[model samples]
Target: MSDPITPTPEPADADAGTYGPFAYLTAPNSVLYRRVMRVLMVEKERFTVHVRPEQVYAGVAVDGGDAVTEEAVGNALESLADGRWGNLLAFPDSSRVTAIEDFYRRRMLFQLSRAGEAAERALAQYDAALGTRGSLQSVALEDIVALLITLRHTVSEHATGATVDAALAHQTLRSLRERFVELADNAVAFMGSIQRTIDLHDADVEAFLAYKEQLVDYLERFINDLLVRGAAIAELLGSLDAASIDVLVTIAAEREAVDAAPGEAETAAASARQAWLRQWSGLTDWFVSTPARESEAKLLRARARSAIPALLAVVRALHEKAGGRTDRTHDFVTLARWFATLPADGDRHRLWRSAFGLTPVRHLSITAATEDAWASADLGNVTPWADAPPLEISPQLRRTGAYERRGKAVRVTDRSVAKALLVDRARQEAEQTAAARRRILTGGPKPLSAFGVLDPESFRLFLALLGDALAAMGPNPETAQVHTSDGELTVTLIRTPGSGVAVINTADGTLAGPDHLVDIASAVDEAAGDLVNWAAG
Candidate 1:
């Protein structure tokens, strides 16, 4: 209903508001208004704002201070209680005439009305709004998950029926049982927290992602761990007579009996047996009975199993939230709707000013205290930053120089040890190289298979030698010895029948397939083994 262009705070009603008695607050001088209001706020309990001009300026007078006087304080008090500021009423709480008998004793007392209370509350609210507002932080699901996992592991270890000392078992059970209960309780609590986090206006996307992932991982892990423990427990429950861990059952039964006594003092053996019989109902409910109120261990497994799908559903909800266009914020969307329907130049201009505060800067001034303005208010020839050198059009421009590696030459703590390590590394390298060569040298000099089927490396070698042998066939079908450049090995090329000139595919033409053969042999060792690939190096 109000003008949006020049939006401002609603003015307090002059006749109806508490500030009516403190009308001097609207004075042109802000310091006096604030100081007087602060004094009232600080001493609101005192019925009389007993002002004495002498006491008001006592500290200032001690420092040889300024022009404050008794008349000034009295004038201020009178002005505050005047008919113009109708919110205050003057009164005397004195029983004796001596209350105002002397100038030093004379003081003004005033009580604030309903309007003053309202004004003070408004100011208090303004001050309070300056504090940091509460912000929503995404769920810390991973921490809870980690704690639950630790508790699960502890339960698993104890449930294995290891022969632990009685005291140790008691301590471990007490500690782990407390932690496990807390973790289980927190799992349910954390789901509510997840919903709260997702509902937040400014939820951290990265933190939410982490929380979602950790929670899903937690649920999956719980499902797996619970299944394993459940199977083990079920087996233990089903095969109590067949197990060698019967001591575990005996110890548990004893523990149950001791607990049923309802006191700290240990019962005698006969009394313990009586207690055990009395408490057999608990044991029956726990490990003996298969129906009607199953044991807590089975319930734990069931809850853990059920929680997986519940967590998965939560994850689906989170994903649905994440997989959407963040079109705009709520406040901005509302503002945009208002702007669309505003349809007025003045309203538009006011909206612009209110949104960005683009009104002219009022408090800035330029003074020639240090330096003069630029000589000309023009930038005709000014150029952006550049090197004096002309841009070169060459590969050198694209080139990058490699940095020299700088490493501190650490003194070897033990010279012999360093030398031994270096030698061992060298020996390892040499042996690896030699082993590759040995595999390549042996069993590779045999005749080419029918249809020229060869290993991948051997096929490459065939291609390279095919052209050379074909070029220098020299009109003879006898074997040709081609010594390699290094002459450490020799390749003997021999012609063989191709089973009546088989035709094969080729780039130039269908090849009259070669009958040439390659027999690999080391020059120094006639009985060399299969060729090693390292020899090609």
Candidate 2:
């Protein structure tokens, strides 16, 4: 337990100060005042609502030590009273007075004020939130499912004219909402913590590596639970009609409406119902899928799945680090130290050459006779250059530091014939492709069956366009449209109800599929038509 807060001088009245109830927190003696208030608050919790000045002194003295005098404690208590910061309520302790001398002392008691208690609660919650690393509570999900089932059954009973417990219904709904809130908040926090863990920020490398095996398993288990249990939850949510949900909301709201002010029962009920309905809507959306969006459950599962790979990547990195691989930076540092200890500049230069081998060797200009002798010799043993015969260097290389070959320059080959053939072949292919594209687009929008018999070139082009459109269509879209890879044409495929298969004859084979409404139009711009044609080629 901590000590209470210090106090300031009492104001003329409870409302005299312009400061709020927590104003003592910023005062010069705020520490002492907070200690005094904490003592009062703790005593209040223990059913000692009104604390005496001596009690406050004893509590403050625990942490403050002898530095906190009785006079200081009394002054701190008075400063926190209703007249000053309104952190405490001052009461006359007449029951303790025994004689005229005791009466003159004016024994008083201190209790925490409503504003003061609210401020303390806020501070306590702030501290808790700051420190909390929330978790993934799969049990919370189970509890939520159970609550929803209970509510569903209760609503059904109420609908069929069966006796129902309103209080139980309200309590169950409240508990369900709270549990859901905790689950969502904890899951988000846990996922965030996992990311930080993966980054290895502030984590012990060895410990994290040891813990990661279990962490990965934990995430995997949670993902499995979510997938299995999430589906059941979504099913339950879908089975409950809006009217049934509204009935339960109404029951919970009416039960709470009793707390409203006089003559405001109807208004309170309506507000509570609206609030409950909004919460219910959020709950439904969290589990049930809509046309425009996937449920949060699916998204959470995807995030968890992605984290598994990331964790493995981190583990791989850690393993590499632990493999005792040589570091480039460390090698450079060691090399620098070796260089630093050298006694001579020439030795340093030689060490640098031996270490890097960046210096060029100039003895490659050997004569034809010498090269033949060196190649034919059975030379396996090492021979220092100092003990070997000198190489025959060319005069030009010795003078200019470069070898000059003694020969005529090679003649450049003529490629104009090959270039002309390639150009002609590309032109012919481009012409054929453009003709095929035009033949398909010229027909405009028509049923797939009406395309009739297409030439091989046109059929290939048609297949390419159809493949692009279908790829854009995804799983079960009613219609899909896409520009060709060359952006010279746009193809659209729209499925129709009760459509039959369409077969198109080609020289190579036949193609068959749903007789969809197919449309291919030229999408080329006049400015970029040349570019598009070149790309097609």
TM-scores for all candidates?
Answer: 0.23, 0.57
Q: Write the per-residue lDDT of candidate 2 for residues 460-529, one digit (tens) a residue.
A: 9999888888788854588998987777787888887456778999999888766788988887653477
CA lDDT of each prediction against the hidden true structure? 0.48, 0.82
Q: Which ten residues in a row have the lowest lDDT in candidate 2?
A: 1-10
Q: Which candidate wins on TM-score?
A: 2
Give stretches of model 2 more than 4 Å off: 1-36, 57-86, 89-108, 200-202, 323-537
For residue 380, what is the lDDT in candidate 2?
Answer: 35
Q: Give one digit per residue, the lDDT tens place, for model 1 in 1-537.
A: 321122122235544634465466676643443444445554465654543334433433343434455565446545655656654445543433353343334344554544655666677787665442321111222332343344334345556954445454434334433444444455555444544654652456557556666756765566555444444434443443323223333443456456554563345434544543444333223323253455644454456555556645655666666797344586688888888998786787778789879675444332343114323333222333352222332343235432222498778586888899999999987676445334334344444434333344444444555556555554344667665456655566677643234443334334444344556666756534334534655
